[model samples]
Target: MGALEPNAALERLYRETGWTMRQLAQEINRVGTERGTPLKYQQPSVTQWLNGQLPKESARPVILEAFARRLLRPITHSEAGFPAPRRGSTPQPPTLDGLVDLGRQDMDPSRRGVLGVGLFSVALTIPGWPDAVGRMDAMRTDPKRRVGQAEIQSVKDMTDRLSDLDDDFGGRYARPMAAAFLVNTVAPYLKATASSETRKSMISAASLLCYLTGWMAVDEGAHGRAQEYYVKSLELAGASGDRMTYCHVLRGMSVQAANLGHGAPAVRLANAAAEASPDSGARMRAFMAGQQAHAYALAGEKTNALNSLREAERAVNQAESQGRRFGGFSSATLAYATAEVRHALGDPKGSVESLHDHFRLRDSTDRQRSKLIFSSLLAERQLQIGHLEAACTTWNTILDEYPAIHSGRIDGQVRRIPSLLSPYRSNPLARQIYERSRELSAK
Candidate 1:
């Protein structure tokens, strides 16, 4: 789907400069090297460019530098760029363009501030946007290459595999790779020819990948970028006419907002998810209820939080009756919500219980990164309960996994252990735990 020949602007501009394609490619590599990153563009990549190809975004600055040196003038992509599919008939050009630009922005080291901007583009969710999706037309493109179920299926399979990698390690492990996939593969595919049905299917698959990528960004502690991806994911889901997936992405955004202690926005977003959704499944309802509980708790609405928790429990019970155990609404989410609300409400003992329940849901093979967080919370709760010995014991478990969990969030958790156990410095067990934790922290 990628080798489209519409880069007329780039080809014509390069031809005007009268440099051989190989020479241009060499100059691009030299510029890239001076910029502290090695690029491997050769004659073939350049030949393909003349034949209609888009260069990688990361290669763009270097390419432009090489061109400007020959032509002796500044340039921009709009003047010397691969032409996107004409938007004259495509209903999805804007969305596809935004996503491609996002990937490109992420690739440029100097342009990183926008990606990390924590401000949610609340303007995107204006009053009529939900209904606005109805105006979109999916049957717009006519490409030389055909995209179908097979290509979309590949994306879904990749999403699943990358999800497992994210669960086991951390989001940083695959976050950039996922973004690269979106830029280098998915973007071009979206521009290819497909029927309405195929386009929606591909969009649906792409939305899932975006959501997973956002989830990893959260895991990477890049909350701003995470929200950015989630917003786009929601938009793609809406374009696909899939309310369930849209609500799912909304819920993910609510979680991050709540985690950031922005209570009002979190609650509002969660409620919006519920109101905007169609007839969601029991598990989804349960997940929503649980999310509401956490958001309310963050807002200091204890009574409302408790009621939400009760509603979530009922929803989960109903979901079990429907033979659903674990997907998005799995037990882990409920336990984590309970622990968070309990802790927020200053019920340390109950928080500890819920935290332990959450851990029980994970076996030995589960991600150690989460364990590091849950265990740290457990130890803190034990300290709050005045069980110094138990606190130290939990800290020991966290230390065991500390060396294996290479995450900034987990690092923050491990670094706070000494301060948390400071009161127990006189206790033998606490002293031993503190020394060990300090040793691990040093590593």
Candidate 2:
């Protein structure tokens, strides 16, 4: 073979990023770690790639993602000097059929491990509300089966029950069951014959369930998988002319991005959600603004972040005066959002205070999963502020309920408890927490 040619396309993009080869490699490694795969690529690896070396197939996505996050835009194979993927380019399936396929994969035991490793991409292409609205083609109805209002209500009721289960236990225990329901029940309903109004209502109901499934996936840390479900939810919501659900899914996507530390994408998605619903009710407005505030804080836009927080607070107060409640968005939720914003803005003390307010505001109806998560956050911040004993006390409360929950995110928090208290292991409380963490982790 002739000598390899220089990759001019990659070289140009590399220059645009203004990153040293080592920095580029480090970013790639970081992305790998986020995807549950630790990589040790060094400057030499990046040097080879710029000099015409092809990255391993698995590394290609990681490399593209690193550049995408830095450039704040999608980076395609051609744009990055990489060849098209060798896999066959199949046409996209119809909406309902695609949902079935996605749900089946999610439910299958063998494919789940593979799904967990799918990388969350900051450069994912999100369809605008106008573009997605009425985008689905006419479905080939299953004339043998018909659905109506009663069926639609059943779907909604089932989704609510599954959501409750997910809250009381955790996504690890609830997601597969949700996926199974989506595949076995919801998919068939989408294809069943019905009047246009009934069909649209059913689609709207299905979209909400899809969103719930995606939220569960996020709790499990299957972020890329969650994005897939979120996109499908958006499409279904749009096809049904359910604008609110579409915006809700977008905000969930933003939450996933924020959790993954992809601040730019998070902010972009949060803004998109708010823009999509101009005349949203006060309660709905608060829901969107709180997430937007979290996103802006993560993006390091202090002014925009503070502005959104104030808007959320005002909206919440307005909503209360009007006696309107929108799902789980309330003062407690705002306090949690405030804590996230403060934490991101380097105000650990303020964040801790907000968290205290959150717990004080929370009632029995709050999701157990969230209680554990926020409590974990409170403990960590307490530890950060030189309140070791207080942190241990908070952690003890978490441990009392930790083994009962099975969320990947919460599991991660528990896994860290031992190390977090290791430095102060000589202290009785710290040692007790550390020992208990090891004991639970072993199980």
Per-model TM-score on C-alpha atoms: 0.75, 0.78
CA lDDT for candidate 1:
0.73
Off by over 4 Å in 1: 1-92, 105-142, 361-367
- Compare the candidates by lDDT and give the number of the best one: 2
Report the error of model 2 at residue 48, Å: 46
Q: Write the per-residue lDDT of candidate 1 for residues 344-380, one digit (tens) a residue.
A: 7878899989988888876555666667777877888
lDDT: worst 10-residue window of model 1: 120-129
**Candidate 1 positional error at 159, Å:** 0.5
Clashing pairs in 1: none
State candidate 1's TM-score. Answer: 0.75
lDDT of 2 by residue, 1-443 (tens): 99998899999999999999999999999977875668999999989989998888767767876886788544556667877654322111246656866787788655667889877989999878887777544554544579998999999999989999999999888899899888778877776789888989999999999999999989988988999999999989988999989988999999999988889999999999999875677888899999999999999999999999999999999988888655568999999999999999999999999999999998878988999999999999999999999999999999999989979899999999998998999999999999998899779
Candidate 2, which segments miss by more than 4 Å at Cα?
Answer: 1-93, 109-111
